[model samples]
Target: MTSPENAPASRGPVVWYAALAVVMLLGVVAVVAARSSSNTVSNKVATAQTSKVKTGSSSKALPQLMDGKADAAIGQIIPAVSGKTLDGDAITIGPDGTSKVVVFVAHWCPHCQAEVPKIVGHLKDSPMPVGVKLLTVSTNVVKERGNYPPKAWLDRVGWTAPVMADSTDNAAATAYGLTSFPYFVVADAEGKVVTRVTGEISMDTFDQLVKAAETGKAPS
Candidate 1:
């Protein structure tokens, strides 16, 4: 028979063992929960990144030119224009002994948004000819507009052309006499303006403009 004092002592070890088991079980549960939560967060992050990549992937549709016409500025010397790129590199435009195709785009223009992907796709599929430098001028950036920030929009479209970020006053656009979005200006190796297209143009028109710029003549 156990004494009254022995009863408490006998129960003490059992209680301690049960308490320890409970604590261990809780610890294991907590660790498992934490790992599960971590995995969930990681999966969400991966899914978001994949979605962004898929959304920005290149399209296969060909582009078409519209309302294209030769400019009066044709045969005139292109202005010595300069601006910074999205990566903060200084870019100067003019006669650099190479034909240049300058594409002026606005972030807020729906037409520009539609045209950009097509241009990128066409350029990727069929690269520009040698001695032809393709450039883009990101202008008219407005926060409350169609695409919001211009830099992100360009990145989203996977624009790989040399970009010249226009100033707050749109100095580059003004220098080129831009009256509309998605404008195209082609200049010869000698910096002479060959032609200007006011709207989106097809790849054939793009090639024609480049050829015209190189030969110092407007596209027929």
Candidate 2:
């Protein structure tokens, strides 16, 4: 038969190889697109987390201080009612039963940066005085400066003290008449204001304040 004499020959090897190459190219393009989308999503998540740390507020209580409330002392007694840490952890609500609470910090303030490492080291390693507690408050709102103390900064500085975001309204800053950075405010076990020091207080000075509060002896 005529058909038996010659059927159209199949595609040549080169043609088939070319088709296979095209298919492989398409697969590579699809994979690249998928990876790009995944990278975008990951980038968005990281940016949001870091941004929140820069501008988030813990709560709204310090605003009352602006209204000129002297009973503010009553409010500071409860730490949870005050502020929160960068990692969304509880800051010092008040002094523990055995220790007074001392806050040493500033938000944009430069000196606070220097004081952090030593203070955290002492607070972590040394035993608390009988009437000592440890707490910290931001003197400035993180604001647009992105200057707020983010968890990243705290971790980088190795500050372990329970820190509060006083940035919402400068409540802590106003409470102690903070005129500068690196301020220290010590509250006795009873949550009474005992000592207020401006500028950097040496580790020795910190000890004196705590020991004096506990033993009622002034710095030697």
Candidate 3:
């Protein structure tokens, strides 16, 4: 055997290279671990962002309204419908101790076109009484339909009521049991449905309905 100091120079270099190889292997493992941790953090942040998003009008759908049918939805609490407006503002129709006359209209309906201007003029002449609010839902929107953009139509008519922009699926209209354009649902201060009528209604009839809702009484 060679003396200790006479060990092969090649042997020394081999030992040094072995040690460097082990260190390089350890460094690679550390980098992999760091990358995995970062990816996990990024995935968690994405999940949290997705969970906070709110889409459409309501979390749960309400019972469908069957107007003029036996066992109608009258005397039932209206569902709390939430949606955004034409101006991207949030709005909700709920039991807030305020009487509400909610009307559902489609931009493509001729009756709605005729009815909206009349209602607008009526409201301008005699505003809703205190604690009674008038609200409109723009629903069944189709870009190819007449009056493509409802905001422009309502603005042209000088409508001042709070207008809720219904979802692509007509969530607001469906919640209110809308079967036809110019549908109307009157709710009392306690959020109970006073009356619901379909088709265009005259201002005199509309006034009566509002009175009934404000007093929590059905029209006789």
RMSD in order of candidates: 16.3, 15.2, 19.2
Going through the candidates in the order shown, the clash numbers are 2, 6, 0
Per-residue CA lDDT of model 1 for 76-171, tens digit only, reads 766766656766776776667888888989888988998889988887878888888899888877655655567777789998997877777776
- lDDT string, candidate 2, 53-122, tens digits: 2222432222222222342433243333345565566454444554454564654566777777777788
Report the Cα lDDT for candidate 3. 0.78
**What are the per-residue Cα lDDT tens digits for candidate 3 across 84-121?**
77766778876678999998888889999999999989
Candidate order by decreasing lDDT: 3, 1, 2
TM-score, cand. 1:
0.67
For each candidate in turn, the TM-score is 0.67, 0.56, 0.71
Clashing pairs in 1: 65-201, 65-202
> In model 2, which residue pairs have backbone atoms overlapping below 3 Å?
79-93, 99-132, 99-133, 100-131, 100-132, 100-133
In lDDT terms, which candidate is top?
Answer: 3
For residue 21, what is the lDDT in candidate 1? Answer: 100
Candidate 2: how large is its RMSD?
15.2
